[model samples]
Target: MISLSLPSPAPPSFKPPNPNPKPHKPKTLKPSSSNPLHNRPIHHLDQAQLNKAISTLDLMSHHNSAADLLTYSLLLKSCIRFRNFELGKLLHKKLTNSGLELDSVLLNSLITLYSKSGDPVTASLVFEEMGERKRDLVSWSSLISCYANNDMEFEAIVKFIDMIELGFCPNEYSFCAVIKACSVKENVWIGKIILGFVIKSGFFDTDVCVGCALIDMFVNGGCDLESAKKVFDKMPERNAVTWTLMITRYMQMGQASDALELFLDMVVGGNAPDQFTFSGVISACAKLGMLSLGKQLHSQVIRLGLVSDVCVGCSLIDMYAKCMVDGTMVDSRRVFDGMSEHNVMSWTAIITGYVGTGGCDKEAIELFSEMICGQTIPNHFTFSAVLKACTNLSDLCLGEQVYTHAVKLGLASVNCVGNSLVSMYARCGWMENARKAFDILFEKNLVSYNAIVDGYAKNLDSDEAFKLYGQIEDTGFEVDIFTFASLLSGAASIGAIGVGTSKQLFKCLMK
Candidate 1:
């Protein structure tokens, strides 16, 4: 016994157990279907997991009623989240057939799904069905918001009025929707009424959304700068949107100095200008023809990493084009060539810049041709600019080609494009062609008629020109001073002045 004890003590001092140990059996994670913990739907899952769950659910046989309503609702929500309209519709039909349509949460989810699907018709139908049952503010707001977001502002405003008539006091979201609709309409009177309601309802002081919308309403309502300033001044807090809207208001009013002052105020107030802010200020500079200010803003834009922004870059080009100094076209071309991504506005800006600087007609024509060859669809403004270039270059051939293009594109009827085409042909001494264009126009405005008449007069076709002047008078158009002057000059050149024509010319001069 003594020897055994001595050996045990010596062994304990000299040896350690085996360094490597066997891993415990991973407790054979029980099958999810069998384990209560695993059977429950995962909570706080990320977007990916939720998506995966939706896919898995979709893979399951449609006959599986074992999938609860909550699971279906969650899948529908995920479909909305991912904007998978087809899957959303499928889930929605299933939920409806399952008699869960009356479920307030499920119904709300369906409304949201339809809204996100861009099928506002279906959303409206669902909303109507909800009205036949128990309804809540969420239901009303969802339908109203869908209408507003989809640019059915008139419908949304009407619905808001209906909602109020139904005795439902609008929440902040409802007010925001109504205000946004008013803003879209540019109805300052309606906006003021809405603002009063917002204030009397005490929503403006508490809700940032209402405040923001109020600001937008004033600014977009044709430079209600005073009201905009009032809203801005009264707000206890202002975000980037508020500041941007104020800056934009000034810019839109052609008040560049005011815009710059506001920009400086924003800086002093510690609000960093975003791309929109910079774009607005740059536009103000463009309107004012302030190249120096535009350049300074451009430098700030580079520092703010917004130089590449399409809108800001376009504004910068426009600003340079509007400068009184020489080399504006060079600066505009430089900006245009430097752009990495080109959209219609990018090309349009450069073309407009060329048009602004006299005798860039060739460059403008080349750019328009390039744009067409690149398969970029030209808009009405594009056609107008190209026609102007044709006029400047006296390229009757090019003008006819552009006219054909405009007719094919169904843009020939647009007043501005039509006017430009008439002027183009007139300037090129193509009076007959100008007359043809005028006749084809659906409705001739004073400008179009005047352009054709002026063209004939300039070409010394006094007979044709006088006939057009009589036609203009017969069409209930009051000839302006320019028209009278043109007619007088044509009569003087052809020695065909009549007493009637002389009296009309005198009256026009008096006018």
Candidate 2:
């Protein structure tokens, strides 16, 4: 949603003298002499420099002159790099008004600009405006990627088919985009058909990117992990991205051990792991509670100069927190402190670690406040962690404030946040608030029932607790040990029950 304000293009006009025009020069503007602007350092320009460049264009228009294709292309590059749609729109207006004929290269850039800006209809119009001679492979590929990246999977697939029927040879980029579309639509059949085409076209042998796309296709289209592994095992070459992809998929499937083993293989194969690779492996260490292994990996991260990466830093923080030795969060805090930047994930990890460590609830709450003050919005996990801290400190006042924040964000009805709110209110001896939070939950699980029932039982409201127990039975929920323990506690508080009542309770428990 980046926006830039510039003057609208006017019809051809003569130059007019400005009495007090400010002197402005764009700094470090080093566009190369041959085919300058489009491929140069215009992307590095700040707002003021970009304004100066546009002002130069304004001066051109004042002289009834149109900027050449190179100038327009460079400005378009700057606009795309900054995601400034308005500036691009202005460029389009000027380009249209100019008598210059659109070349395929400039048209391709326009297609890409519109596509990446999430305006596929305009992209389609631009594509349609091109003659058959002007529609090159890059033009087709850009359109396919636009559709695939913007959730138009069906259109992407159809366009791939159309491109093939039109006698255009599909390249690696084309295969990757179409395969991604198939993956999104769960069209494994079409993906495998494309795999055959890939092999026949020799892209599978020459381009590792095509192979990687196939692996992702099979993995995301509900195929087994072994299918993805088969593609991985047969690749002619593997880059850090390819290795990281497999490792990450393994982690997503809950096979952390398998992911770790693959990382070892990746290293042994002389492949260098990137920040994402290190992050995935460190997460494996965290899951297995391998503190020593995690520390070794941390050393590797520091050596590789990736310790400053936000993702790697977050993963290290989480690993050290989960692998706390002697109940000390010193390692986790040290990692958090050393991080150059903090995103919501990093902030949540540190706050959660402090909450899980004993006697650090106040510290956790303070960190949460700091996160808010830094303009980092808290997610459901963040709210849950701070609410747990509130419960531990018996700070109902702070808990209520946190709940208000969650409500404002509309996360109060989210399952994890709602469950945490109920637990916090119940523990704080506010059954009414607890019940209100419970009722608004979009869906409830056993934990929700247990929290309210336990609250009533502990408060010696045996009648309400028993009624909730009946409702639980009517709903066909299998009563767990917690329910039995709470009901027994309630019964004991009201003195011994008669034989018939005891028999009925035992019967329900057996069921």
Candidate 3:
């Protein structure tokens, strides 16, 4: 039984703040607009505003805005906190302009700032500027982490080898970075080598950091869930990150039920879920399409004060959208409307839900319009989803317009979007346009072939559909049962009794 406390009822705040949120807008020092640091106690400003203050001072050319130890440290912290590469770049330019010595501490912060912001190019530039002799262990670790965090696994692993060559022994953080890097590329041999390093460095048992990272590397990176479970089972301690990682990996592997089981275990064991934990389990519930379970989780989110978290809010939007029956995206829209921020993921999730669940495709398309007007860059998935909506609505003109948008965005060639366009054009009886889309695609998976062929077939183009059916074999795509069925149906529709009989016999032989 999943044991959870019935959360204390509170006056409706409507949207919940993330757990560990800033204390009701604490009385932090505000930087004056004229001069960011003027009349400001530097230490009293929150990291977020401190970053802004730093930017304002730089912009105003505050010549006296020196990068003192305290001021620079706060600036670096701000860069890390905000994931603001532009701010980090400004700070770096200011540091060089000030002719200040690039100390190890300052350089590490810059490297970390750039790395966390997914800019290893600049991070490496900072690392290369520092001589190896001047670099302490922290510098080496940060440089490796810069690559690892940015998904440059090869770069990170190569740097780790170089660090080992330089005789700088690996620490727990270094191991964590290396392990995380391994999780992306699934170089199990390299991961095995990293495990050896873990054992040799005497961190395998003692360092809980390595233990959790190893589990993540195995399950997430290597896709070896059994091994991850073993590592977690053997670990003497596990924190929220570890538990959250395990749950998320389970979801990634399509083991949402197992993820929910572990989430229950984590809660029952008194490990109160943080934002990520709730996000993962709620996502699992959404996948299961269990509306009641999803609602229960939403209540828990409200009670735990995580509704305002962008990630949590996004998950809630997706969950409510998926759990609701067709044409019932009201709850999902409410969450999106209430959110203080909306990233591409949040927008994509709701759009996908609306289209995929056969809900309001028109609403999905309208939302996409709003997203574009708001300047949220729509990726190929967004194009794919909205195109699907157009197909469902039989809005060929609108579908063609979205296809134009896809071309403008360089997403027209994306497999799913391309397939969707073919499907859309076909469903709307635009055979010539569908064939054009089918012809231009560089690669055609079974789904692609099915979409285009089905489109042509459904439109009563018996000759064109049969030609394409023959071309599927020439192109080395085995015709599936769906192919024969659709083709025979097309033949039947065109009153081609002979072709239908031949296809039926061929299908039976193939089967």
Model 3 lDDT per residue over 461-480, tens place: 76777777777778787778
Which lDDT tens digits does candidate 2 get at residues 1-511? 2121212223345545553376665455445344333323243354445655665665666666556776677778787887887778777877887788988888988988999889999999999999798999999999999998898989999999999999999999999999999885467888888889999999988898888888888778764689889988888888889999999988888899899889888877777788899999999989988777788888878866789998998899889888888788898999999998898999998999988886899999999999999999999999999999998998999998999999999888888888888888888889898889888889888777888888777777767877888888887788899987887787777774667558757986888
Best by lDDT: 2
Compute the lDDT of residue 363 as modeled in candidate 3.
Answer: 80
* Candidate 1 lDDT score relative to the true structure: 0.76
TM-score of each: 0.73, 0.75, 0.75
The Cα local distance difference test for each model comes to 0.76, 0.83, 0.80
Find the 10 residues in a row with the least total lDDT in model 3. Answer: 1-10
Which digits, one per residue and each the tens of the lDDT, describe model 1 over residues 27-80?
321223543322333332332465455445433434362445666766677778
Q: In model 2, where do residues sit more than 4 Å from their true spots?
A: 1-48, 97-100, 131-133, 377-381, 391-397, 403-511
How far off is model 3, as Cα RMSD?
6.3
Off by over 4 Å in 1: 1-122, 132-134, 146-155, 184-187, 219-223, 373-375, 400-416, 429-511
